[model samples]
Target: MARSYSSYIVAQSKRTPCLQNVCQFISDDCRKHDCKIVSLEFFAQDEKPRRTDLDQLNLEALLNTDVCGCQGRLIIVEDLSTAVIETLGSCLDIDPLFFASQIHGPTFDIVSSKPSDAILPSRALSQNFLSVQYQRTVDFGACSSAPRKMLRNSNVPRKIVLLPPIKNRSIGLEQQSCSILLSTTKSKPWLGLILVDKPNSDKYTTSEKQLVLPSTPFQGGYEDFSERPCFFEPDSGSPGRVSLLEDLVYYWEKERPPAFQPDQPTLLSLTYYPLKIAAAEWVSYVAVISHSIKQFEYSTEATFEEHGLRKIDSDLRSLEVWGRRCLQTSSKLQSAISFLKYQINGAPELEEYSLMIRDFEYIADLVTTYGRRLEIMVPVVTSVLQITDTRRSLKEAANVTRLTYLALLFVPLSFVASLFSMNGGVSAHDLTIYFAVALPLCAMVFFVTRLPTFDFVPLGPAFGKFGNWMRKAL
Candidate 1:
């Protein structure tokens, strides 16, 4: 017995008339070719079926007459060509070259030439269609061969070639889309291959333009290319494409040389790597350089006290000269000291390394002036104390001299008064006057002996302890 096979064309459509007409045309064509006409299933608008689960349904049996013995083939004919394209593109298992040959007209030649890997179901093809069934598996080899033959015949100004994505282990082609966009809209018509993985899954959509470089002939090899992954957003526009040539140029300019140049062997191997990787390494190198500069600045700032002191001392000399001029007047000396104190206590600006050095120099100047003055002032203070002691001694000596002079003047007077009182005439009254004068003279002697001598002491341990205690209290 001869084996019987069946073919089924599964399609979805909103427009009933167009769906019915297309189904009838396909059924008539199958019969003319000596194939048995199974059943024509018209899924009306009310019978809108979901396409997602269409593969699992008894679509083959519903359209085929002899189910058990039939070898089945499914050909989807839809009014929405774009939607049909997109739906088929998303089904990874479905080979698009098998059905793309059914599209009518010269456009079929160009469409057929496109790599089967590039075929993507378009959103427009999802709207409306019909389904047909037959008893044999569809042969797509003839359809696959037509695309390459078409490319050979056409002298189109721009050519778009789509190649599969690179795989780590396999040499076989991966799914991809390629199209050429003409720079001059009039020169060569734009060609597009829309690829869809799923309604919402990853879709590969791309556009390319041809360029003629001054150094190269137009007939040479196609160099300029751009590609992008496309997705449908509810209201958003299409996806953008990145040019491979442009990407290469950008990475080439951005990449930096290694800090330490490697040996020739390593350098030659590095040249084979992608420019993006090289650029990343260059960025990392620059970051390290910047960090090192900061570290050096910090180290220098930390050692500013040692290296920066000389500059500070020079400024200090000027401050000391000013201090000396002001010191002659006590009030100005106090004002100068207050200013120096204020400067030391206030915060300094050291944001930049150079600024920190400048500030250190300023500080050095102030310290130099203050340091020198402190040294000179300490000895001067000692000398002044000695002079004060000498002055106190001289004052005490003068007081004693005065007391001696007073004693000389009053003793004779007192004696004379007593002598007078001793005389026989008016003796009682004279004695009373002599006693009053003698009493005042003794009081004066007592006061002169006690007052000035109280504070005089030798500079020894006791005096040193007393001085320290005084300082602490102050």
Candidate 2:
């Protein structure tokens, strides 16, 4: 008997009512069909999702994921709301499935949200710094009979910086979207490298209109290469597709060395910006973290230690996720470069590749440095926290000692006063009453110490008014 099909209900996830258009039966419904797969992308220009659905839509799909190996779910948001962060935390709280569960708990990782407070470099990336060889043929050959100085800048440090956004930045190269080439024989798509961005009026220059050509399939017109560029639409639905867009990139993969195993199907929107802009964002992310690390490393006061450590840990995780993503992204861009070389003869694609590689190198080093720094600092920070706890324990012990002495002073009086109430040799009965009074009194004293409220601070009235206003406002 043929299996019956469920109505196309655009089923909502049990996690949230606001979550809609979930592809519930795609895999089963198309099992026997000609293997048609449709993947969708919500670009950076699209409107943000409603606040309520934020948790269930992206997060719910991301948790039960199998993407590139040794990574966690990454959600890049324009606005970092408490709800979103909380949702992300819950999604990562625990991987319940036997296959998905790797790290005991909390797998979802968010790399960045909002504009970074990075100590941004003054110059645009294009003008940041080019390698310049300063050389002079000196007659010092006469002074030493041979060149005394064979100084080569082998270990010269390049400034890793987040550049300020450029205005009227010449329309970055016009590129084509990815496409698949069809064959009459066996069925399998030839994955193509796609264009990541297009020239926009605000960012790209007017010259782009003429320089940029519409994407077209190869027709043996290889001589006039400027008219076409190779671009492939990334298929998010299949894990076997080596080149992946941000939306399809997996958070957690169990495989080692991350081989191409496109067996899983994923559906969700990801934060996708132009490649250049994404690189810029990642750089700023690193710079801001580096700055924050510097602040903690140099500060003389202990005041920043507590909150600072939390921030440090959070940023560290972000770096680790960002690093893996960059590594994967860089590998994929190589194909793009090769395609550019073929499509646009004598294009400066190699230079662009170098720039990306340089940034990638910096990103890798930053992650390594941060990881080592954190490994060292974690122990030291833990010791400091332990010391704090010891100090607090000692203070509490001292207070307890004082209370014990005061209780001793009343012991004889309380006993003698209770003697009168006891019918001769009914002292045990009176003792039970004594415990009732003493137990309550001790409990009150112990718990009162924990309360932040003090007699001198009249904060109740003001706090009450604030609470009332907040309730009305909400």
Candidate 3:
């Protein structure tokens, strides 16, 4: 038997010309973009996934077939092409603007309902668009071919520095962007499209690679490359690690499924993972910063002991960079969480997904706490740095005071010697006369400089009383 579109879509095709027209549009758009569907799966209430290769699937016959009872569908694509966006909009009866927002704008999470003037009413009245970032270990193989110069020693051991977010710098860490589109339709089960844009090594041009600290995120590789795991294999009996997005679509496909899909609301509950993961990253980042601050103190003390109070302007600069990075990342995370909370609460379709509501609320609270923690660290870091600067200044001042003491003792002796060397002075060979004049002059100058009134006294009480008498004589 030949494979076909999901039963619900086929059934709806017979009743509504709008869905058929949308399917036709998807086909036309797909050809225009030269796009290929990575994978497509259809699910019914109590049946196995009717998975098929969408690239070879015919879109025309899909509208003529008659089938029923599709509870959900999943489409996985490597790129967010125009065709994918339009198809999602048509299927869920949503505005394409919601799905396209992340493309041109910044990454964020938003939930939107069908506009009042939408042509078709959807059973799933709301749609969710999520854009989240996740950290991944650098792929050295992919990065090696990039236009950027690789470190001389490929395996050179270097300490991972998070202050500058080495992960984002194409160093030891990489951040991948995951854009998810989730919705359900009157004719289809829960539908989800995931577009994971891996960091392209070629995205960074030669000029960008030369920067000591690039202003923008570093592109991992600069060469032509193909993204991997474009399609997530459905979990079989073997245990495997599935990401939250993958877990959402293939939940029922798991051998020991954690929970059955009660309805589309249940699917909404899974949306919590993105925000939760983001918050968790924030907590981890703050923890790293706190530890780094402690390390900064210890290292500074050791540096002072070994190098004798050398200036650490570089360390201060690094702290400033870390602070700015923290604020920028934290603000973004907060905005994303706040927006998600507001949209989810106001969305009528999500009323049944109570777990999702609570999850986001908890995330909001935790983010608030972590943000405060980050803020508190600022003063503590500043204080530590301030103490270092003060110590350096004091050390410099102490050296100056010792030099002043030497100058006090030497200046008068030097003056007497100069007089003896002149033609008008007694013979230079007259050692007795030279000692007689130089010793007294040097002693007088030293005593006057050490007098308490002049505030040069650094001796005991014996010197103190003598110095006070000298001050009166002066």
Over the stretch 1-474, how does candidate 3's per-residue lDDT look in tens digits? 633333334455455433443333334443322333433344445455555445423422332233466555555543344444544444455434333323321212133221211232232224455555533333332232344332211011111222322323333333434555665444444565555442223222233452223322223222111123325764243211223334333443432122335235333343444444444444444444554454334343523342333324444565565556555555455545554555565666554334434544554455455445555655655665577667767888999999978876777778877877785656557668889989998888775766665434466677677677765664
Overall lDDT per candidate, in order of appearance: 0.28, 0.30, 0.44
TM-score, cand. 2 vs. native: 0.28
Candidate 3: misplaced stretches above 4 Å? Answer: 1-37, 45-50, 53-71, 86-94, 104-190, 199-207, 210-252, 255-367, 405-410, 422-429, 454-474
For candidate 1, the per-residue lDDT at 125 reads 23
Worst 10 residues of 2 by lDDT: 96-105
Tell me the TM-score of each prediction against the true structure. Answer: 0.18, 0.28, 0.55
142, model 1: CA deviation in Å? Answer: 99
Model 2 agreement with the true structure over 1-474: per-residue lDDT tens digits:
532111112221233221111122222232211111222222223222111122324544543444433122223222122233234334332111111111011112243111111112232111211111111111111121111112111111111111111221111111112211111112122111111211111111121231221222111111210113336744323122112233222222211112212222111011111233334334444443454344334233333345755644544454454345334334334433333333334546345434444554665566556656645555555555455556667778999999976775565456555654566654677778767766665554444433443232465666545545543442
Highest lDDT among the candidates is held by which one?
Answer: 3
CA-only RMSD, every prediction: 37.5, 27.6, 11.9
Instruction: Name the candidate that leads on TM-score.
Output: 3
Candidate 1 Cα misplacement greater than 4 A, ranges: 1-351, 427-474
